[model samples]
Target: MNYRQEVEALQPQLIEDIKALCAINSVYDANTVAENRPFGKGCRKALDAMLALGRADGFVTHDVDGYAGDIEIGDGEEGICILGHLDVVPVQAENWQSPPFVPEIREGKLYGRGTSDDKGPLLAAYHAAKLFYRKHPDCRKKIRVIFGCNEERGSSCVRYYFEKMPACRMGFTPDAEFPVIYGEKGTCSIVVRGNYRGGKLLALHGGTVANVVPQQCSAELLGEPAEYEESLNKFLTAHPEIRAELKGQQTHTCLVMYGQAAHASTPHLGVNAVAAMAAYLEKVCPGPISALIHRKLTDYTGAQLGIQAEGQLGALTMNLGIAKYDGCKLELTLDLRIPHEVEADALAEAVRMQVAEYGAVLEYQAGRALILDRESKLIQVLDAAYREIEPEGGEPQAIGGGTYAKAATNCAAFGPAFPEEDTHIHDSNEYISLTSLEKATAIYYRAIEMLMAD
Candidate 1:
């Protein structure tokens, strides 16, 4: 059968596998972490589910101490690896129309936390591998589908897995947009902390992860409740997109504001709750903390911090993701996506100097960038496969998002996410279009066939 026919035959099984994997609330939880399950019980459960599927499909599956697992097919000295992750970020149940973990199909879109971000794409690639092997059992190279449990927090799971095993000769990860991604910006995370003098600002909290823009923030301010309520009403009137609520008594008032969430790589699409709350507090809480927020944290880019740069990989983007002030102490986490042309340490020092001006301590952690030659054999093959299916598709491009391509050798992000569709990755109501999933499966099958062909 042709590639499309094969994918059509496997669509039901693929959808079932994707749904089964998406049903697990695989967010990393340290509280349930154990010997083999380093990430948590939920993540361990997700890993086992994938391996179980592989075993039932008559493929050799191995779980690398719960940190990662792989399903292997074929036999040869050289191998091809397709890396993906099963762990998802924490979700606000109230924000989603449907339960985040319960996979649902509506209007031809599969809605769930992992459906668009990863689980859907992972299964698509797996089914492609299965189809290729079934048609060509004597293919010369082995195919390995590697799944990790800690990609959301960090790639420690894959790091440990790679250290234990040898690198594949060639591979691609279906975690980003299609055509193909040849360059990915460097990632830097900064934690800013300082003493907070309790005044109008008694307590503040916002955000869940550093890579996602915070959609909600709450603050307790020292002020007359009625006056604060009036001010909040005015703020809401001016900015209808942000919803605010006021509570508490006469002397102290609590405020909550809701904004839109998006991935840090594309912060312009999000309305950061941390920034919005800080903007409001700048007027009521006149202090160093508020000053820092107004001066450097409000913008999506690092222009105010004097660290912004633009290059082939794109402009440096920043997300003021998490913020908290507990009456006397304050902490803010910043996620920055840096272009390949910029120096990460130099940028970090500049950010450190900027935050230091406000008496805040800065700690930086950097993830190295990945850049592959567009003319390389791997890129050529993947690009050809995509163009074969999508005749008018654009050429391979750069991205700000980091993927397992950096963790694996000779790899780049090839996709299940189409340029025309918004997958809402790392955001609320995340879903994958069924058409995109099918096309991606066929592309993966074609790419694998071309790569393995002599």
Candidate 2:
């Protein structure tokens, strides 16, 4: 059945709801943790807002102890699930032309921090399920739209959810690129820390999380701002691609570098500010942390670290997501997307040994990769639903992104992001096109109808 008209009819409310939800700075805040508010007050508010939306529409909703929440439609025991996250990555507000939390529409696209990440897609799934049951009251099929508050960090919210609730029959997460995703790169975060003493650098900081390329990095060095001005100008002139400036403090000079931010899965698209700052530091200050970062982090991939690998899915990638050096201690967080062909253990050992050369200690946390057969029932049904709408769409593909699908069984990342469209998720000026919003809503509606049929 055609759902274009029904999906379009919901656009006005959908936009308003998107604005309301995206307005909350749902970035995980450790400072605001409490009993019922785990991720933070922001995420807690987003979760409550979503659950309230479900309840207002007459659906049964569960709080799942504030780590996550779900809205249940229909009274059936067996059903399909839709997994999504309400928590978003941290944003560098100065990079945005419009306030990151204040969503606005410009030229037919909704722009906000979470507009294209998972919030927009999550609502699309919600509206689709709402539309489905509204159009078919007698339908016994169930749809549970799960919202998690810890996806950007580690998805502990959904992990806590399944501990309290049972997994559904089959499901999909509308948090990735279009057509369908049957394979995703395994993800891991490696943090290295060490001591740095008697260096020109006093303090260095960059990036927010281990999943996004840092957009801005600032370092305070032991010198006059005027002392570094000529050298900084010379450096910027020699390296025209890098954008940086020196800020003066009484006894120290602060070197700030600005780079483009992109999701860690696609680090090549962004210029890592930390790496750029390290390059400059290696020349002027020449400390262990700066030298190591300059030597190791210049490449987006892990070729310098010798952990790069290629498999059926794709080549491995690494993002120097977070870096900090406070007078005495140095820390760096690297986010790596590994292919199945490479052993994660071996890669970790290699990185650990490399970092040890610089007198640093390494800690690694590994996650599982997802790989499903192309002919599986879930893939077949989802592909059919997608093909029903766009006959010329691409086949099921693999991505470097880690989605909620990995946290559940019999699930994969599905549409919300069209292949040709770059929503600039996890970056400044992130937006979701009006056409994509309506199209994704209709696609979810069709997928739900088809999944419920069988």
Candidate 3:
């Protein structure tokens, strides 16, 4: 079948499906979590909605205790798989042009929370597979499209699904940039806790998740209004890019700092509000936590922690993704993307030692790096499929972002994001273009055809 023509013909249906899926507000709610719905009501609804789509199209669907679900195209035991997630990172709706859950189309772009991250890409791959199977219904090999609901929160959904199910022959996830991803850096998050005897620094908070650079940070300092206003003004003058304010309270002053948010994998692209606040505190209300954050957390390269390293995949990068201080105790979660050459344990130990010096304790969870050989058949096939779709596309590359590919065997994260386009993923006004959807659908169709060749 002419894949491009088929995808183009189905644009309207595709857009509606994307809008419907994106409308669910599946952000992994902990409040409504239950026995079957492990990721909570929002994610469960998303998983159910996706399964309904598959079942409507005469495909076999399975809900794996709500942690994840799968739609199978055939009866064969093992074949190609398509991995995609339904859960999204938390969003500050006030920053969006429209209600985030209400999907909108502006200038040929579908705007919503999960539109760019994985939902749009997930459905693109789904429609592509649907088209392929519609042409080859009698084909023996099965095509399993897995829908994960906890990808944003450490991919526990896929982890549980794969644990309960069999691994596919090979697959690709539509969760990352175009061309193809052959390698991915290892990801780890370290939890640091420290106690502050100083009464000047009161409550502090920042960030929503451990994978996004915090855009806003606030700290309550026990002091008069006049104590911090002058110094904050001078600091703001020095760094005009940072937006901050001092709100006076009866017994304390609230210092609010604002910065640009970006995916933790590319921390350099973001201005971390937590780090900026630390810098301000280091200057005015100097304390152990502030000094530690200012000295070590400000740099994304792990330079201050003395654990920077680079490998074939990429360099080590870090983000101060979460921070909280409740008057006396401070807690922080630092997300680190480590290259393959650097041992995750060694890196964690180095950070632990550094954090220990400032009277803090640390605990970590390390996810190993994924390195697929460029010369491997899987990479060659995926690369060929991408090149066939876009002749002028760039070579396959490594990314610091972790995806469902890390949890699945014989799979890598393929298209959805084009290098030139900024989808604003993990931020407000996230979107997926109509052009991207059509192109990626065609690419996935071609890749599935090639993978399932007789």
Model 3 Cα displacement at 73 (Å)? Answer: 1.2
Off by over 4 Å in 2: none
**What local lDDT score does residue 62 receive in model 3, on the 0 to 100 scale?**
94
lDDT of 2 by residue, 1-454 (tens): 3578989999899999999999999998999999999888999999999999999998899999899999999977757999999999988788798999999999999999899898998898888988998888888777888999999888899999999998868999999988899999998889989998997899999998988889999998898898788878988898776798888876898889988889999999998999989888888879788878988766877989887788988989999999988888888999999898888788889988888888898899899889988899889888988888888989999999999988998998998888788888989999999998998898898888888888
TM-score of each: 0.98, 0.98, 0.97
lDDT winner between candidates 1 and 3: 3
Question: Which clashing pairs does model 2 show?
Answer: none
Give per-residue lDDT, candidate 2, residue 359.
Answer: 88
Worst 10 residues of 2 by lDDT: 292-301
Candidate 3 yields a Cα-based lDDT of 0.90
Task: List RMSD in Å for every model shown.
Answer: 1.2, 1.3, 1.5
Poorest 10 consecutive residues by lDDT, candidate 1: 223-232
Pairs of colliding residues, candidate 3: none
- For residues 1-454, write the lDDT of model 3, one tens digit per residue: 3767888998899899999999998987889999999988999899999999999999889999999999998776667999999999998887789999999999989999999889999998998888887888788888999989999889988989989998867899999998799999998889999888764888889999989999999998888778888899999999987998788867778888988889999998888999999998888878898988999778999999998888899899999999999878889999999988887788888998998889999899999899998888788888899898788999999999999998999899998988788898988889999998898888888898988883
lDDT rank, highest first?
A: 3, 2, 1
Model 1, TM vs. native:
0.98
